[model samples]
Target: SLGQFAISENGGIALAQISNHYLGNFGMIILALIVIIACLKTTVGLMSAFSETFVELFPKKEYRFYLLIVSILPCIFANIGLTKIIELSVPVLMFLYPLALILILLALLSPLFKHSRLVYQITTAFTLLAAIIDGLNALPASLHTITFISVIINFAKDFLPFFSLGMGWILPSVLGFIIGCLCQITITVYKNKKSSTLS
Candidate 1:
């Protein structure tokens, strides 16, 4: 139990190594961005392709074309990329109440054990501890900002209807997937056929 809680010297060294690996090559960031963009394109292409094939195997959705358009944003959550995006265009997300509620449900249910309060409690506790520690540790040198202001972005908005689930990187991707399925079927079929005939 003690060992489980202890932060080993080896662990610290490994973490430092990992950090260095990430922050080391300046050119690697560009290479990685290129690779990430390539992979996302491949992923979407494959998904659209497989979806096309699967319809022959199984039943197809009525609204597949509209949904694909909503999922155009490239899937990336690296802090480096995110900071760049924030500097470029910090989206003020506003949605209709129904859409907002749907996003909330998509986030909360999340394919995990549905309605499991214990799991939620444990997850929340871990999240809270990490967030609070980040706040405290980042406070000393950046001592100008008081603790009160730090609390807003720190706390969870699990109960709030119109909430920003900032801790998650996957949610936007998943939401994109869902909204894709909901909106983009007809156009996708035409484009799929046109491209298929050419290929």
Candidate 2:
């Protein structure tokens, strides 16, 4: 079924093909409806949130204006074809994934770290640098040919572990967290010693 369709052309084509093959016309219709309904709700929610946030951030712009812009941009981009949109989004997603993962980890370990701002800042700073490198590495081969990008990629390949496997951010994030913890401890000790000496 999927063999008949070019799945690479559109992300949904393969899903549609599979549904049509196993359950015929009815399955296709159901799948279409499900996708439409899911997308509709998601779009509405995102647009509302985006417009509201922008309106607050830039009070000169009205909510409706922001909403209109957000709505129009997606429509224009959608015309570019799903494959192209996905190609553009991959690097962005790669850049964000590590940052998001680090945040989640920090939240989970907040109790142990005593919710120290230093830990969060240091860890995120290190992770951000590595994530940027990862995103650059994920860029198209043509972009990778650019001198600076190629140099960065080569440096990461030489010095960063698991970079080839796309797990390059792991070591940096851990090291940052450890360094942050040490800094926090040192600060606390210094403050305590200073207070004792003063007393």
Candidate 3:
């Protein structure tokens, strides 16, 4: 159990190598099959998700057209080359990932906030600032030939706790939540006073 849990991120590749050590050529077959199945499942999931979102966002568009658009874009990117696509996409994905995670976390915990729009907006706005910096920092040094991103990252690193560990949004998110709660309390008090006066 300990060994299984201790496996690092490259554990699958390590496992495949071990299998090859024990099973020889047959292990390669097993590894290939596993990878192909995993890739196919992921491809299907991504295609379905993108197609559904595209159709829903532009309801007037036919599903076939949306699907084709989804399909062709990947094909074009693939043809342009996978490595190039990844190079261009890494910063974007990095930028988007934090926002996605924060949004999902906020949505899940929204009930705790009584679904307050002020809380949601404030928290998300703060998170957006951190996420943008994180995304730009995700870009390679070659792309950052300009000093601006480096300067922002330096400032964030100095002031934002956990910025080094990719959790820079945590502090801002908490601050936002606190401010939002205060706002809610103030609004509630004002409303109560107005109601009592009217009575």
All candidates: TM-score: 0.23, 0.91, 0.79
Local distance difference test, per candidate?
0.45, 0.93, 0.80
Indicate whether candidate 1 or candidate 3 has the larger TM-score.
3
Clashes of each: 11, 0, 0
lDDT of 1 by residue, 36-124 (tens): 79788887777677667655565655336423533443443334354355433323222122234444654677554444444344444
Q: What is candidate 3's lDDT per residue for 11-55, written digit by digit as tens?
A: 555666677777888988988898889898898888889889988
**lDDT tens digits, residue span 1-199, model 2:** 5466654466577787888888899999999999999899999999999999998999998999999999999989989888888889989988999999999999999999899999999999999999999999999999999999999999999999999988899999999999999999999899999999999
TM-score (C-alpha, index-matched) for candidate 3: 0.79
A best-first ranking of the candidates according to their lDDT comes to 2, 3, 1
Evaluated against the true structure, the overall lDDT of model 3 is 0.80
Candidate No. with top lDDT: 2
**Clashing pairs in model 2?**
none
* TM-score, structure 1 vs. true: 0.23
Cα deviation at 13, candidate 1, in Å, is 27
